[model samples]
Target: MVDYKLELIILPVSDVAAAKAFYDKLDWRLDVDIQGEGGFRAVHYTPTGSHASIIISNGLTDAAPGSTRGTYLVVDDIEVARADIASRGIEITEVFHEAQGGIPSVNKEGRTPGLAPERASYFSFAIFSDPEGNEFILQEITTRLPGRV
Candidate 1:
């Protein structure tokens, strides 16, 4: 048997410096920034308490800038997290929840204003984007689903 862990996500950006600055404003930890020969460069960032990391670099991926979407960041409290981030000067969408009989989506197909009724975990979310328009979703999850941990 073997164990595998998700490690890194590569984000394509037109300007590495702008992307780096955006993540810095979010207060995510900047793990590393390195420049290599032949004009190679990579800037790594990790959200607080996250096991995985994201790398914004040149030539590591072929995806276009702002193509990344629906990347979810789990939080214990969506409101608090949203407020904290909004205070950081980032524009985030108001907290929204999946309506009954509706699946969660990056689009606002079945989303309702404010938090989920009674504040259920994994049902509420807020959205924001980086300078490159890379979309990120912040989801509330106080308790993990079975086998998630």
Candidate 2:
């Protein structure tokens, strides 16, 4: 049995410099930036405390900018994580939890007014997007369910 790890995600952006600057503002570690022949360039950044990193590159994929949505970044504390990103001048949607029926909402619809009243793990979330509108959700998860490592 081989263990597989997801180490990187490719983010599509129209302006590489602007996207690089935006991620840089988040204080993510800049791992790579290389310019190759024929206008090819690749940039890599890793968020703080994240084992997974993100790549923003030219000539990488055919995916459209801002097309990726609902990508999640799990956090131990939703408030702190939200505040940190907000303080960096990013506009984050209000913290929200799923409606009482246990079905998670899609995008902005069906979300309850505020944080999970019970502070339940994996229930609270905050939303934000990059310059090109690639959506990312910050989900609070203090404890993991079975088999989740």
lDDT of 2 by residue, 89-120 (tens): 99998888888634356745678867787788
lDDT of 1 by residue, 77-107 (tens): 9999999999999999999888872346755
Lowest lDDT block of 10, candidate 1:
100-109
After the best TM-score superposition of candidate 1, give how far the Cα of residue 55 lies from its true spot, in angstroms: 0.5
True-structure lDDT of candidate 2: 0.85
User: Which ten contiguous residues of candidate 2 have the minimum total lDDT?
Assistant: 100-109
Cα lDDT for residue 31, candidate 2: 96
Q: Count of backbone clashes for each model?
A: 0, 0
Q: How high is each candidate's TM-score?
A: 0.92, 0.92
* Candidate 2 wrongly placed segments (more than 4 Å): 101-104
